[model samples]
Target: MSEHTRIDCDIHNEVPDLEALYPYLPDHWLAYCRESAFNGPDAADYPESVPTTARDGSSPKPDLAEVQARVLDDVEIGILNCAYRVQSVRNEDLAASLATAVNQWQVEHWLEKETRLRASIVVPSHSPPLAAREIDRWGDHPGFVQVILPVRAEAPYGNRRYDPIYEAAIRHDLALGINYGGAPGHPPTPTGWPSYFIEDYAGMAQIFQSQVISLVCEGAFERFPSLRVALIEGGFTWLPSLMWRIDKEWKGLRHNTPYVRRRPSEYMRTHLRFTIQPLDAPPNPLHLAQILEQCGAEDLLLYASDYPHSHDSQDFLLDLLTADQREKIDSANARTFYRL
Candidate 1:
């Protein structure tokens, strides 16, 4: 395969300035800023939230050119730039408005700025009704492939309140992505401490687990046969165990949820695809071979850099897959999932 064929599935586009997109919000809303200083209780004499001043003392700015060179161009990646402000806006109405505005701005400023970049519709989970409307409004954007959701709320993703949003995803032929955030009002954990931001970040995988389980068992998959779902930011290793547990429970409780027509594992292979980043080192090419052997090789795992947030390089990951596997993970899989 040509180097340009490689598709880095996961990349983060930072939102340091919301003014152009969020013209409706006052200066104060755009002004509240913080910087990650390695300080505080978990701080290494650095502040976790330090606001950076522009040379003239303005809002934090995203270094787009650097991002393009370091991540997109270098990896030869076709990027999926997930939006940021969706999770931060808590109010249902405000959240919906912000999501629409951000997506529109993304088309005009970000994605259109780069041929390789793509984006998603950031829906407001706080209000499924308005979210559904917003999804209907822009679900058909050729650049939009998934519904970006931050899995920070305590409510089960299977709750009926979210049905409209899911329905919208199915209607638009878009994938539903569950990402994580540091938003307040979210449940801390079964063992609560509210300790540190990193601690909360660690809990992201579990939140995905809960959402996936709730959706599958609750028959959301069966209901929306055409809808595809992706779990981004969260690593893929957790999937094997989660799929196993879902299967074990299904054998015992199959009668309770008759709507589910296939084994949980089957559902995963058909409707699910995951972004692979923060991957554990493969013992060798053989270990990587074994992983693809077990999981559905084509259209199963995707390549992502989590760019700017991490090194955003694919050299290590690319070295793991064989020629055939590399072709699948790099391009075919993403093209199939996003219908590119």
Candidate 2:
């Protein structure tokens, strides 16, 4: 691939509304949604009014033309992650149906229309059996490169209940993308619900950290050696500290989890990749470079614009990286990971 070729690993393709999915949904679910007056799943994470949810002047539900102008023009390839909040639905059957609809909707509306685009297979992650079934349905589709699960779940993704989802993903050779959203009917933080959105938003790094710990210590990587996970939208600045802490604990406590055969940080570095959106950069660009070196994250980071969701400029971060490191983050890493 050309050094200049950029593969945006994260971008949103909004599902306009319930009506838009009506064509793809089954008759039973279509009637149920219409009669029950369901306005579709609620926004589980980002509030609609916030400027961060939709950048100034960017469309909340961008059409193909808007995406080409705003996103595709800037990159060689863009992977679409539809944050439809299907996991927020309490009814298991309905949630599964909605997930299927979302995947099909992406196929007809976006992936087919734009060859430059690829999408994540949305799943009803609350129910792993159904989620695995959804993954199996479209896992072979060339247009889809990963299985998207919300970062927030009823249990850590490494729990036994989620094994079927992982197995199916590995069988299909698809990466697992844990995007930042989902309402699992629990508080966003370990301390319980916060009064303000800022508190919840800031606490997301903790959630990602817990999931990483769970995946590593629980031996998900050991069980499925082929599994690859992408931590999307969650910031990457907290990684170095988490790696140090986990490695330290694993050294003395490895007896408790015999399945974890190697150091936690080793498994993390091998199996996980993080998108560099919402980058929590320090005041000095040199500090950010040092953090990347501490974590040995040159091959672990992937480029993402997180289109339609605003974030601070990343030119400083880009400027600090070596030409080779920047090329890997820009496109090479994603190309190899997504098998594009």
Candidate 3:
């Protein structure tokens, strides 16, 4: 690749521990936490901490400066959108406080120190009102560019309950970001929970598909025309298949979802954005190009390292594409999509 601008659209920042959040909590919650002997919730079961870190050039222990030197400076990222791993809480108020603490920690520790860092506002999974309040608090902060939710949400994200959340995003000119992480309300798989990590990994694409369908069929995009949903760590191959399937079904089943006036793909094209971390490298490299063309995703795609988490063979996934595509994926597309 030639000299080009790079912007990392997805990167993980682990909140060291719960004790770090105590200072940000209300007195009652603080007392409750101390009284309950709440050190922290057990670490969520995400599989990224396996051998893939060394395999993919991620630090086993990624602190702010370590990430800055190894991932950001190494790749020459002009901006890195930091997403936290702090969304596993069950209580609404406590969840909001934890999210706030993580953001505050980032603001004081990372954003204030690093010039190239920007982040998503992590919100409580089950509470839209509280989530919206978090957005309202930090939406104006230059360091926070979007509101981040997990695609593995308590419900399909576009349900009416989440309208207030999206409304807050629109009201604040912040994009809504959805990453991977399932909640308990839904089965990990369509049939049942996965027993192994591979099974869980296999279902991630389906999770993304279900989310896009929910957003389109439920008219989330229509209701908030300016609203944009960034699918961080959401891979690309399944998108074409979903677009075709939904548009085909919508033609015959429009009455069931009259709010979706246009073809499903049309709305997705206008409203959704996806990160390219674990890029869909097919057996035949040329076939990858076909997938991009089939899905009409040249502009919709954003480049992400998924730093210290997903291990891409190469830092960027546009090596197979033409030079122009490489340039756009590197920085231009992210600039427009995130309104940076």
Which residue segments of model 2 deviate by more than 4 Å? 1-3
Q: What is the lDDT of candidate 3?
A: 0.75
- Model 3, span 296-319: residue lDDT tens: 777888878777775556443566
Compute the lDDT for candidate 1: 0.66
Candidate 1, residue 28: the lDDT equals: 41
Go through the candidates in order and give each one's C-alpha lDDT. Answer: 0.66, 0.90, 0.75
Point to the candidate with the largest TM-score.
Answer: 2
Question: Which scores greater on lDDT, model 1 or model 3?
Answer: 3
Q: What clash count does candidate 2 reach?
A: 0
Report the lDDT of model 3 for residue 245: 93
**Number of colliding residue pairs in each model:** 11, 0, 0
Residue 281, candidate 2: C-alpha displacement in angstroms: 0.5
Q: Candidate 1 residues 1-340, lDDT tens each?
A: 3564667776665554454554544444344322322111111111223321111222223456766766666555456555454544555555666667677766777678887777777777677888899889888877878788766654777676788999988888888877645353645575665577566656667777787887788787788787688777766666777888999999999999899889988888887787876564355767655665666544587877665344223465677666787788877888888877
What would the C-alpha RMSD of candidate 1 be, to one decimal place?
6.0
Relative to the unseen true structure, what is the C-alpha lDDT of residue 141 in candidate 2, on a scale of 0 to 100? Answer: 94
Q: Following a full C-alpha superposition, what root-mean-square deviation does model 3 have from the true structure?
A: 2.2
Rank by TM-score, descending?
2, 3, 1
lDDT of 2 at 53: 83
Q: Please report how far candidate 2 places residue 129 from its true position, in Å.
A: 0.9
